[model samples]
Target: MRSSLIIIGFFASGVVLGLSGKLPNGFDFDKFGSYALYLLMFLAGLSIGSDKNSWSVLATHNYKIIWVPVTIIIGTLTGSALVSLILPSLTMKESMAVGAGFGYYSLSSVFITQLHSHSLGVTALLSNIFREVFTLLATPILVSYFGNLAGIASGGATAMDTTLPVISKYSGKSYAIIAVFSGIVLTILVPFLVTFILS
Candidate 1:
Protein backbone atom coordinates (compact mmCIF):
# COMPACT_ATOMS: atom_id res chain seq x y z
CA MET A 1 0.00 0.00 0.00
CA ARG A 2 2.83 2.35 0.73
CA SER A 3 4.41 1.61 -2.64
CA SER A 4 1.11 2.19 -4.37
CA LEU A 5 0.75 5.51 -2.56
CA ILE A 6 4.24 6.56 -3.59
CA ILE A 7 3.51 5.69 -7.18
CA ILE A 8 0.28 7.68 -7.11
CA GLY A 9 2.13 10.60 -5.54
CA PHE A 10 4.79 10.59 -8.23
CA PHE A 11 2.14 10.39 -10.91
CA ALA A 12 0.20 13.26 -9.37
CA SER A 13 3.36 15.33 -9.10
CA GLY A 14 4.15 14.72 -12.76
CA VAL A 15 0.65 15.76 -13.75
CA VAL A 16 1.00 18.92 -11.70
CA LEU A 17 4.36 19.69 -13.23
CA GLY A 18 3.08 19.15 -16.73
CA LEU A 19 -0.02 21.23 -16.21
CA SER A 20 1.89 24.01 -14.47
CA GLY A 21 3.91 24.57 -17.69
CA LYS A 22 6.78 25.86 -15.62
CA LEU A 23 9.27 23.29 -16.75
CA PRO A 24 12.68 24.55 -17.70
CA ASN A 25 13.17 25.43 -21.37
CA GLY A 26 14.57 22.68 -23.60
CA PHE A 27 13.57 20.04 -21.05
CA ASP A 28 12.14 17.81 -23.80
CA PHE A 29 9.57 16.01 -21.66
CA ASP A 30 8.70 13.67 -24.51
CA LYS A 31 12.26 12.44 -24.88
CA PHE A 32 12.60 12.11 -21.14
CA GLY A 33 9.35 10.17 -20.94
CA SER A 34 10.50 7.73 -23.59
CA TYR A 35 13.81 7.21 -21.82
CA ALA A 36 12.03 6.66 -18.53
CA LEU A 37 9.75 4.04 -20.03
CA TYR A 38 12.69 2.25 -21.57
CA LEU A 39 14.44 2.28 -18.25
CA LEU A 40 11.39 0.91 -16.49
CA MET A 41 11.11 -1.91 -18.97
CA PHE A 42 14.79 -2.67 -18.59
CA LEU A 43 14.54 -2.79 -14.83
CA ALA A 44 11.52 -5.05 -15.03
CA GLY A 45 13.47 -7.42 -17.24
CA LEU A 46 16.48 -7.24 -14.98
CA SER A 47 14.47 -8.10 -11.88
CA ILE A 48 12.80 -11.05 -13.55
CA GLY A 49 16.12 -12.26 -14.94
CA SER A 50 17.82 -11.99 -11.60
CA ASP A 51 15.13 -14.06 -9.92
CA LYS A 52 16.05 -17.71 -10.52
CA ASN A 53 12.75 -18.81 -9.03
CA SER A 54 10.81 -17.22 -11.89
CA TRP A 55 12.31 -19.59 -14.40
CA SER A 56 12.08 -22.62 -12.13
CA VAL A 57 8.47 -21.87 -11.28
CA LEU A 58 7.57 -21.83 -14.93
CA ALA A 59 9.45 -25.03 -15.49
CA THR A 60 7.55 -26.77 -12.72
CA HIS A 61 4.16 -25.54 -13.83
CA ASN A 62 2.35 -27.50 -16.47
CA TYR A 63 2.54 -26.22 -20.02
CA LYS A 64 -1.26 -26.05 -20.02
CA ILE A 65 -0.84 -22.94 -17.88
CA ILE A 66 -0.39 -21.14 -21.19
CA TRP A 67 -4.14 -20.82 -21.23
CA VAL A 68 -3.90 -17.96 -18.76
CA PRO A 69 -2.76 -15.38 -21.26
CA VAL A 70 -4.94 -16.87 -23.96
CA THR A 71 -7.95 -16.44 -21.73
CA ILE A 72 -7.07 -12.80 -21.08
CA ILE A 73 -6.78 -12.09 -24.81
CA ILE A 74 -10.09 -13.67 -25.61
CA GLY A 75 -11.88 -12.07 -22.69
CA THR A 76 -10.61 -8.57 -23.43
CA LEU A 77 -11.40 -8.73 -27.14
CA THR A 78 -14.82 -10.20 -26.47
CA GLY A 79 -15.67 -7.56 -23.91
CA SER A 80 -14.59 -4.86 -26.31
CA ALA A 81 -16.69 -6.37 -29.03
CA LEU A 82 -19.72 -6.35 -26.75
CA VAL A 83 -19.08 -2.71 -25.85
CA SER A 84 -18.73 -1.79 -29.51
CA LEU A 85 -22.19 -3.16 -30.07
CA ILE A 86 -23.52 -0.72 -27.49
CA LEU A 87 -21.32 2.10 -28.82
CA PRO A 88 -22.21 2.40 -32.46
CA SER A 89 -19.70 5.14 -33.04
CA LEU A 90 -16.82 2.71 -32.68
CA THR A 91 -16.38 -0.24 -34.99
CA MET A 92 -15.62 -3.69 -33.61
CA LYS A 93 -12.08 -3.44 -34.91
CA GLU A 94 -11.52 -0.08 -33.28
CA SER A 95 -12.87 -1.26 -29.96
CA MET A 96 -10.77 -4.38 -30.10
CA ALA A 97 -7.78 -2.23 -30.94
CA VAL A 98 -8.35 -0.27 -27.76
CA GLY A 99 -8.87 -3.43 -25.71
CA ALA A 100 -5.62 -4.81 -27.00
CA GLY A 101 -3.88 -2.34 -24.73
CA PHE A 102 -4.47 -4.79 -21.88
CA GLY A 103 -3.58 -2.16 -19.26
CA TYR A 104 -0.36 -0.93 -20.87
CA TYR A 105 -1.84 2.50 -21.32
CA SER A 106 1.16 4.58 -22.27
CA LEU A 107 2.53 2.60 -25.19
CA SER A 108 -0.88 1.38 -26.31
CA SER A 109 -2.36 4.89 -26.35
CA VAL A 110 0.58 6.23 -28.31
CA PHE A 111 0.34 3.36 -30.78
CA ILE A 112 -3.39 3.94 -31.25
CA THR A 113 -2.80 7.64 -31.80
CA GLN A 114 -0.30 6.94 -34.54
CA LEU A 115 -2.47 4.30 -36.16
CA HIS A 116 -5.83 5.99 -35.72
CA SER A 117 -6.68 9.35 -34.12
CA HIS A 118 -6.01 11.36 -30.98
CA SER A 119 -9.61 10.85 -29.88
CA LEU A 120 -9.31 7.10 -30.14
CA GLY A 121 -5.93 7.29 -28.46
CA VAL A 122 -7.50 9.06 -25.49
CA THR A 123 -10.15 6.39 -25.33
CA ALA A 124 -7.51 3.69 -25.26
CA LEU A 125 -5.60 5.53 -22.59
CA LEU A 126 -8.63 5.90 -20.35
CA SER A 127 -9.79 2.37 -20.94
CA ASN A 128 -6.42 0.84 -20.05
CA ILE A 129 -6.05 3.14 -17.05
CA PHE A 130 -9.42 1.98 -15.80
CA ARG A 131 -8.39 -1.61 -16.33
CA GLU A 132 -5.29 -1.13 -14.21
CA VAL A 133 -7.15 0.69 -11.44
CA PHE A 134 -9.98 -1.80 -11.41
CA THR A 135 -7.57 -4.69 -11.31
CA LEU A 136 -5.64 -3.18 -8.44
CA LEU A 137 -8.75 -2.44 -6.44
CA ALA A 138 -10.59 -5.67 -7.13
CA THR A 139 -7.86 -8.31 -7.15
CA PRO A 140 -8.35 -9.26 -3.52
CA ILE A 141 -12.08 -9.80 -3.91
CA LEU A 142 -11.57 -11.58 -7.17
CA VAL A 143 -9.02 -13.84 -5.58
CA SER A 144 -11.41 -14.70 -2.78
CA TYR A 145 -14.16 -15.64 -5.18
CA PHE A 146 -12.37 -16.85 -8.27
CA GLY A 147 -8.90 -17.76 -6.95
CA ASN A 148 -5.37 -16.54 -7.70
CA LEU A 149 -5.47 -17.14 -11.44
CA ALA A 150 -8.46 -14.88 -11.81
CA GLY A 151 -6.69 -12.15 -9.90
CA ILE A 152 -3.71 -12.43 -12.20
CA ALA A 153 -6.00 -12.34 -15.22
CA SER A 154 -7.53 -9.14 -13.99
CA GLY A 155 -4.13 -7.44 -14.08
CA GLY A 156 -3.58 -8.05 -17.80
CA ALA A 157 -0.20 -6.68 -18.91
CA THR A 158 0.27 -4.72 -15.70
CA ALA A 159 0.78 -7.97 -13.80
CA MET A 160 4.47 -7.41 -14.44
CA ASP A 161 4.64 -4.05 -12.70
CA THR A 162 1.95 -1.72 -11.43
CA THR A 163 -0.58 -4.34 -10.42
CA LEU A 164 1.94 -7.01 -9.56
CA PRO A 165 2.12 -6.00 -5.91
CA VAL A 166 -1.62 -6.29 -5.42
CA ILE A 167 -1.70 -9.55 -7.33
CA SER A 168 1.17 -10.98 -5.29
CA LYS A 169 -0.43 -9.90 -2.09
CA TYR A 170 -3.82 -11.38 -2.83
CA SER A 171 -2.86 -14.31 -5.02
CA GLY A 172 0.03 -15.76 -2.98
CA LYS A 173 3.74 -15.63 -3.66
CA SER A 174 3.66 -18.81 -5.71
CA TYR A 175 1.66 -17.04 -8.40
CA ALA A 176 4.11 -14.19 -8.86
CA ILE A 177 6.02 -16.00 -11.59
CA ILE A 178 2.81 -16.70 -13.42
CA ALA A 179 1.80 -13.05 -13.10
CA VAL A 180 5.08 -11.87 -14.56
CA PHE A 181 4.96 -14.37 -17.39
CA SER A 182 1.38 -13.54 -18.21
CA GLY A 183 2.20 -9.85 -18.12
CA ILE A 184 5.17 -10.21 -20.46
CA VAL A 185 3.23 -12.29 -22.95
CA LEU A 186 0.31 -9.87 -22.96
CA THR A 187 2.59 -6.88 -23.22
CA ILE A 188 4.28 -8.36 -26.28
CA LEU A 189 0.93 -9.07 -27.86
CA VAL A 190 -0.57 -5.62 -27.27
CA PRO A 191 1.15 -3.76 -30.11
CA PHE A 192 0.79 -6.56 -32.62
CA LEU A 193 -2.81 -7.26 -31.76
CA VAL A 194 -3.78 -3.60 -31.73
CA THR A 195 -2.07 -2.90 -35.05
CA PHE A 196 -3.41 -6.03 -36.65
CA ILE A 197 -6.97 -5.28 -35.63
CA LEU A 198 -6.65 -1.64 -36.64
CA SER A 199 -5.12 -2.46 -39.99
Candidate 2:
Protein backbone atom coordinates (compact mmCIF):
# COMPACT_ATOMS: atom_id res chain seq x y z
CA MET A 1 0.00 0.00 0.00
CA ARG A 2 2.77 2.39 0.97
CA SER A 3 4.74 1.37 -2.06
CA SER A 4 1.78 2.01 -4.33
CA LEU A 5 1.34 5.47 -2.84
CA ILE A 6 5.03 6.20 -3.32
CA ILE A 7 4.82 5.11 -6.92
CA ILE A 8 1.75 7.27 -7.49
CA GLY A 9 3.56 10.15 -5.89
CA PHE A 10 6.48 9.73 -8.21
CA PHE A 11 4.16 9.52 -11.18
CA ALA A 12 2.30 12.62 -10.13
CA SER A 13 5.60 14.41 -9.57
CA GLY A 14 6.67 13.50 -13.07
CA VAL A 15 3.39 14.78 -14.44
CA VAL A 16 3.79 18.04 -12.60
CA LEU A 17 7.33 18.41 -13.86
CA GLY A 18 6.28 17.73 -17.40
CA LEU A 19 3.36 20.13 -17.24
CA SER A 20 5.59 22.80 -15.80
CA GLY A 21 8.25 22.30 -18.46
CA LYS A 22 10.90 21.54 -15.86
CA LEU A 23 12.52 18.84 -17.95
CA PRO A 24 15.22 19.57 -20.50
CA ASN A 25 13.98 20.06 -24.08
CA GLY A 26 16.52 17.63 -25.56
CA PHE A 27 15.69 14.69 -23.27
CA ASP A 28 14.71 11.54 -25.14
CA PHE A 29 12.21 9.70 -22.98
CA ASP A 30 11.52 7.17 -25.72
CA LYS A 31 15.06 5.82 -25.91
CA PHE A 32 15.55 5.90 -22.15
CA GLY A 33 12.21 4.16 -21.62
CA SER A 34 13.15 1.41 -24.07
CA TYR A 35 16.36 0.63 -22.23
CA ALA A 36 14.61 0.75 -18.87
CA LEU A 37 11.95 -1.66 -20.09
CA TYR A 38 14.63 -4.11 -21.21
CA LEU A 39 16.39 -3.82 -17.87
CA LEU A 40 13.12 -4.34 -15.97
CA MET A 41 12.34 -7.46 -18.02
CA PHE A 42 15.84 -8.81 -17.39
CA LEU A 43 15.45 -8.22 -13.66
CA ALA A 44 12.09 -9.97 -13.63
CA GLY A 45 13.64 -13.02 -15.32
CA LEU A 46 16.59 -12.89 -12.96
CA SER A 47 14.29 -12.91 -9.94
CA ILE A 48 12.39 -15.89 -11.27
CA GLY A 49 15.66 -17.74 -11.91
CA SER A 50 16.84 -17.05 -8.36
CA ASP A 51 13.67 -18.41 -6.77
CA LYS A 52 14.27 -22.13 -6.19
CA ASN A 53 10.64 -22.68 -5.25
CA SER A 54 9.45 -21.40 -8.63
CA TRP A 55 11.97 -23.66 -10.37
CA SER A 56 10.88 -26.61 -8.27
CA VAL A 57 7.28 -25.97 -9.16
CA LEU A 58 8.21 -25.79 -12.83
CA ALA A 59 10.38 -28.89 -12.64
CA THR A 60 7.46 -31.09 -11.62
CA HIS A 61 5.94 -30.54 -15.07
CA ASN A 62 2.53 -30.29 -13.48
CA TYR A 63 0.13 -29.29 -16.20
CA LYS A 64 -2.37 -28.13 -13.63
CA ILE A 65 0.04 -25.49 -12.38
CA ILE A 66 -0.28 -23.69 -15.71
CA TRP A 67 -4.02 -23.30 -15.30
CA VAL A 68 -3.49 -20.29 -13.05
CA PRO A 69 -1.86 -18.19 -15.71
CA VAL A 70 -3.97 -19.68 -18.47
CA THR A 71 -7.17 -18.74 -16.71
CA ILE A 72 -5.91 -15.26 -15.90
CA ILE A 73 -5.01 -14.59 -19.52
CA ILE A 74 -8.37 -15.83 -20.69
CA GLY A 75 -10.32 -13.89 -18.07
CA THR A 76 -8.45 -10.63 -18.63
CA LEU A 77 -8.78 -10.75 -22.38
CA THR A 78 -12.42 -11.71 -22.19
CA GLY A 79 -13.20 -8.85 -19.84
CA SER A 80 -11.29 -6.43 -22.02
CA ALA A 81 -13.16 -7.66 -25.09
CA LEU A 82 -16.41 -7.03 -23.29
CA VAL A 83 -15.30 -3.57 -22.27
CA SER A 84 -14.53 -2.72 -25.88
CA LEU A 85 -18.20 -3.22 -26.79
CA ILE A 86 -19.16 -0.25 -24.64
CA LEU A 87 -16.06 1.91 -25.02
CA PRO A 88 -16.06 2.74 -28.72
CA SER A 89 -12.88 4.77 -28.28
CA LEU A 90 -10.92 1.51 -28.00
CA THR A 91 -10.96 -1.23 -30.60
CA MET A 92 -11.21 -4.88 -29.56
CA LYS A 93 -7.56 -5.49 -30.32
CA GLU A 94 -6.46 -2.38 -28.44
CA SER A 95 -8.51 -3.33 -25.41
CA MET A 96 -7.09 -6.83 -25.39
CA ALA A 97 -3.60 -5.44 -25.88
CA VAL A 98 -4.06 -3.27 -22.80
CA GLY A 99 -5.41 -6.22 -20.83
CA ALA A 100 -2.35 -8.26 -21.83
CA GLY A 101 -0.31 -5.97 -19.65
CA PHE A 102 -1.54 -7.83 -16.57
CA GLY A 103 -0.60 -4.95 -14.29
CA TYR A 104 2.94 -4.55 -15.65
CA TYR A 105 2.23 -0.97 -16.64
CA SER A 106 5.75 0.27 -17.33
CA LEU A 107 6.56 -2.12 -20.15
CA SER A 108 3.03 -2.16 -21.48
CA SER A 109 2.76 1.62 -21.62
CA VAL A 110 6.08 1.93 -23.41
CA PHE A 111 5.17 -0.71 -25.99
CA ILE A 112 1.73 0.83 -26.44
CA THR A 113 3.15 4.31 -27.01
CA GLN A 114 5.60 2.96 -29.54
CA LEU A 115 3.03 0.85 -31.36
CA HIS A 116 -0.05 3.07 -31.16
CA SER A 117 -0.82 6.47 -29.67
CA HIS A 118 0.41 8.29 -26.57
CA SER A 119 -3.17 8.60 -25.32
CA LEU A 120 -3.67 4.84 -25.41
CA GLY A 121 -0.30 4.37 -23.79
CA VAL A 122 -1.42 6.56 -20.90
CA THR A 123 -4.66 4.62 -20.75
CA ALA A 124 -2.77 1.36 -20.46
CA LEU A 125 -0.55 2.80 -17.76
CA LEU A 126 -3.46 4.01 -15.64
CA SER A 127 -5.61 0.97 -16.31
CA ASN A 128 -2.89 -1.44 -15.24
CA ILE A 129 -1.98 0.70 -12.25
CA PHE A 130 -5.59 0.68 -11.08
CA ARG A 131 -5.74 -3.08 -11.54
CA GLU A 132 -2.82 -3.49 -9.18
CA VAL A 133 -4.07 -0.91 -6.71
CA PHE A 134 -7.48 -2.57 -6.61
CA THR A 135 -5.83 -5.86 -5.77
CA LEU A 136 -3.78 -4.35 -2.99
CA LEU A 137 -6.74 -2.51 -1.49
CA ALA A 138 -9.29 -5.25 -1.91
CA THR A 139 -7.32 -8.41 -1.19
CA PRO A 140 -9.19 -9.26 2.02
CA ILE A 141 -12.60 -8.84 0.41
CA LEU A 142 -11.47 -10.79 -2.63
CA VAL A 143 -10.12 -13.60 -0.49
CA SER A 144 -13.25 -13.65 1.65
CA TYR A 145 -15.68 -13.89 -1.22
CA PHE A 146 -13.72 -15.23 -4.15
CA GLY A 147 -11.23 -17.52 -2.35
CA ASN A 148 -7.45 -17.35 -1.77
CA LEU A 149 -6.30 -17.76 -5.33
CA ALA A 150 -8.54 -14.89 -6.30
CA GLY A 151 -6.23 -12.51 -4.48
CA ILE A 152 -3.32 -13.80 -6.50
CA ALA A 153 -5.34 -13.51 -9.66
CA SER A 154 -6.36 -9.96 -8.82
CA GLY A 155 -2.73 -9.00 -8.29
CA GLY A 156 -1.53 -10.04 -11.74
CA ALA A 157 2.29 -9.63 -12.01
CA THR A 158 2.27 -7.76 -8.70
CA ALA A 159 1.51 -11.00 -6.89
CA MET A 160 5.29 -11.55 -6.76
CA ASP A 161 6.26 -8.10 -5.62
CA THR A 162 4.06 -5.20 -4.43
CA THR A 163 0.93 -7.16 -3.57
CA LEU A 164 2.70 -10.29 -2.34
CA PRO A 165 2.91 -9.28 1.30
CA VAL A 166 -0.79 -8.59 1.66
CA ILE A 167 -1.59 -11.75 -0.26
CA SER A 168 0.81 -13.72 1.92
CA LYS A 169 -0.68 -12.32 5.11
CA TYR A 170 -4.24 -13.03 4.05
CA SER A 171 -3.88 -16.10 1.83
CA GLY A 172 -1.14 -17.92 3.79
CA LYS A 173 2.32 -19.19 2.83
CA SER A 174 1.05 -22.04 0.67
CA TYR A 175 -0.94 -19.75 -1.60
CA ALA A 176 2.06 -17.45 -1.60
CA ILE A 177 3.89 -20.08 -3.62
CA ILE A 178 1.11 -20.11 -6.17
CA ALA A 179 1.15 -16.30 -6.27
CA VAL A 180 4.85 -16.33 -7.07
CA PHE A 181 4.33 -18.89 -9.78
CA SER A 182 1.41 -16.96 -11.25
CA GLY A 183 3.27 -13.66 -11.05
CA ILE A 184 6.32 -15.13 -12.75
CA VAL A 185 4.28 -16.51 -15.59
CA LEU A 186 2.31 -13.29 -16.11
CA THR A 187 5.41 -11.07 -15.90
CA ILE A 188 7.15 -13.12 -18.57
CA LEU A 189 4.12 -13.10 -20.87
CA VAL A 190 3.23 -9.37 -20.58
CA PRO A 191 5.53 -8.01 -23.26
CA PHE A 192 5.13 -10.83 -25.76
CA LEU A 193 1.35 -11.01 -25.44
CA VAL A 194 0.84 -7.23 -25.52
CA THR A 195 3.06 -6.89 -28.56
CA PHE A 196 1.43 -9.83 -30.29
CA ILE A 197 -2.06 -8.52 -29.69
CA LEU A 198 -1.17 -5.02 -30.85
CA SER A 199 0.75 -6.30 -33.87
Top candidate on TM-score is 2
TM-score of 1: 0.73
In model 1, the worst 10-residue window by lDDT is 1-10
- Per-candidate TM equals 0.73, 0.83
User: Which regions of candidate 1 fall more than 4 Å away from where they truly are?
Assistant: 1-61
Candidate 2 RMSD computed on C-alpha atoms after optimal superposition onto the true structure = 2.5
lDDT of 2 by residue, 1-199 (tens): 6765776787789889999988888999888877876787788678768978766766657687689888999999999999999997889999999888898877788778877888888898899999988998999999999888898889898888889999999999988878888888898788789889988
- CA lDDT scores, all candidates in order: 0.82, 0.85
- Model 1 lDDT tens row, 18-124: 79988888976556656775676576567667877557645656776788899999999999989899898999999999999998887788678777886898799
Q: Which residue pairs of candidate 1 clash?
A: none
Worst 10 residues of 2 by lDDT: 53-62
Residue 70 lDDT, candidate 2, scale 0-100 = 87
